[model samples]
Target: MPVPTRKRSPFLTLLPWPERKALAEALRTETVGGLVLLAAAVIALVWANSPWSHSYETVRETHFGISALGLNLSVGHWTSDGLLTLFFLVAGVELKRELVVGELRTPAAAALPVVAAVCGMIVPAVLYVVVAGGGGGSLEGWAVPMATDIAFALAVLAVISTSLPSALRAFLLTLAVVDDLGAIFVIAVFFTSDLNILALLGALAGLVVFYILQRKRVRGWWWYVPLGVVTWGLMYNGGIHATVAGVAMGLILRATADDGTDGRKAEAMSPGDRTAHLLRPYSAAIAVPLFALFAAGVSVSLASLGDVFTRPEPLGVVLGLVVGKTLGIFCGTYLAARFTRARLNPDLSWADVFALSVLAGIGFTVALLIGELAFPDGAVAGHVKAAVLCGSLISAALAALLLKRRDRVYRRLCEVENRDDDADGIPDVYQQGQGEAK
Candidate 1:
């Protein structure tokens, strides 16, 4: 008997091969992710500030979910809380990978990025407080500018510098990873409300169970999915943000199986790597963009822009991202190198570090999320969002100019290194220098 083939979805079948290929590639590329995020944010801003602005607000505030279980929330809240959990889960997996085998495995390798990330967070916070101190806005927003959006920064660098070395990219990725982990901690600690001790303990109990299951080599997704949902629900009930549950789930998954035997015929992938691979595209392309669309739709006008200048909060955020971020990262990296006697890779330079430091100022995702958490349903929240957009834009433009200059230098270096006489592949200077050494 012949078996029937499963019917393909119209969505997949309708798309052209080239378009699907481009989308698959784009989902894997940080540059494309950043562009999509930017496009979403821009579209949101235009819609919010346009003639149909009230309609945008109405849609954002529309209620959804089952009210009986206290699951109902505004559209924006669902995006921020429900959708962003996926992103955080992926982040958790990445954090585990870095800790287990990546650049963060060794203290010596992790020192510079850790120090830079710490300083990068601290200086901006201090600057925010200083600029907005004693002002009309609350100081609760100190953490708003403390994040570095890795996707945006990498996108900028990728566009402007094709010859940029991988070492530099690795450094930036490490710093952002640390920065994001810190931001998660801050959210769980500082932003939670009406904490329930019993529910929190339940959440902990669930986490312990999840960890034990992984230790026992529980490999099926069917077993873990329900556990994750129950944990998330318990976390939300405990007055903790549901997103923290995702992070918890991510950290507990085994980077390597506990058993010594490499049963590859049965065990195909590590838990963390498999989970990340399954979820990263969804988190990047769907969850993040939806979050951006909802979080970024702030109505802006000339009057509001004028008012932002007057308010300490907006100015503080702008300066925090544009100036504080650059200063903090550069000084921190410089100090780490000075004290530890750690040498930078030969392909990198102080100028390159400085340029990348400025790019780190693009604090979009976490910054906007924190702004909403800090001043929910307040006028200042809108201003904070606007300031985040403006600040990130300025940083991207400045980094582009700086990186362009550096790109020229790298191109010349590449050309010189590739220069060959007598139609030989090797450069003449290299051959001549080798002859002398011999």
Candidate 2:
């Protein structure tokens, strides 16, 4: 008898329906947001190169801040340093959920993505060092390619991978969650300057209070909103990226269930989940696009284009994203499945993994942020930003080509699987003794 394909998942843990739906919706929202971000980038690019370029720069450099809080960031800084925190908060929540209740909860489920993500980060930094640092160039940009923009990657995948194995998307999600964590660690550890111990202590104290509130099953936005703001500000004053505070607050939130008056139950949605759902749309539509507008507006010229490839640092960024990410991710997953006890999901092919690995190279949002941090001077930073955009576009195009080909192959496989049926002439998915269809 032919085996049924509908219900079996040898390697991936299928999430409950509600969680699955939420994850799907979140991906969809981010996918659309990616398109909007692209539009914003285009607008910025055009505006920067236009005769009105001075106006764009004037607007970006305009300063506005709360005097008492000691925050007087420029408009561009407001977008990157302030508005981008929403994105970090949502990412942190997703990471927490995955660790607590999703595939990453178990070592078996985590092994492949964890290995892939770690190598994905390490190889890029190594490649950047080889290209840039080896020449005695500044090594500050090494971490720029260590990120994979989830929205951009997912948008590309969704466009050309309709028939790919479901496990592939799951793998990308977990891999990206781990990638985001790596990026966050790099920003906090390396980008920070002029550490303020008092402000740092204040942020820690705020987080402690937040944890206590959650433990007490506290409710209402009033308790959390102001506290989160204060903590974020304190983190900024502490000379750390303020976005770290968002991640801290998100991690402190309970993931298994909401802090409701009701007893702890498996069925209840978590506060973190609830918050993520509410904030994700705002983050995707407004926060990210805004950041791209400010961060991606590089003054385009033939000279800058040439510099991206000719200069050590900029060329290193391009190679890190285009070459290092693909090699790192594909080789990492391959090594894990071969040498370790881990097994690849039977439903997905090595071809699919390769295509997905290519897709993981779209490092836009955090890449820009890191490039900004690495090179504060406008001229060099513009060249680096151009490199990131060019590299990401090339990766997206290559991944789309490969995934579309794999999608055709998987479509044929799925058609074959759908034909298998029981003696009763029913589809195997609905046959007797089969588990209820998910």
Highest-TM-score candidate: 1
lDDT of candidate 2 over 1-438, digit per residue (tens): 998768766678788899967765763465677888889999999999999999999999999998878899999999998889999998999999999998799999899999999999999999999999776677889999899998899878877767887899899999999999999999999999899999999999999999999887788899999999999999999999998998888888889774545765343567898888878777887888999998899888898899989888889999999999999999999999999998788887888889888999999998999999889886778888999999999999999899989988888877766766433467755553466543
Cα distance off (Å), candidate 2, residue 296: 0.3
Quality of model 1 by C-alpha lDDT: 0.86
Candidate 1 off by > 4 Å: 1-22, 67-69, 134-136, 256-268, 420-438
lDDT scores in order: 0.86, 0.89
Query: What is residue 354's positional error in candidate 1, in angstroms?
Result: 0.7
Clashes of each: 0, 0
Give the runs in model 2 whose Cα sits over 4 Å from its true position.
1-28, 258-268, 418-438
TM-score of each: 0.91, 0.89
| Root mean square deviation (Cα) for candidate 2 | 11.4
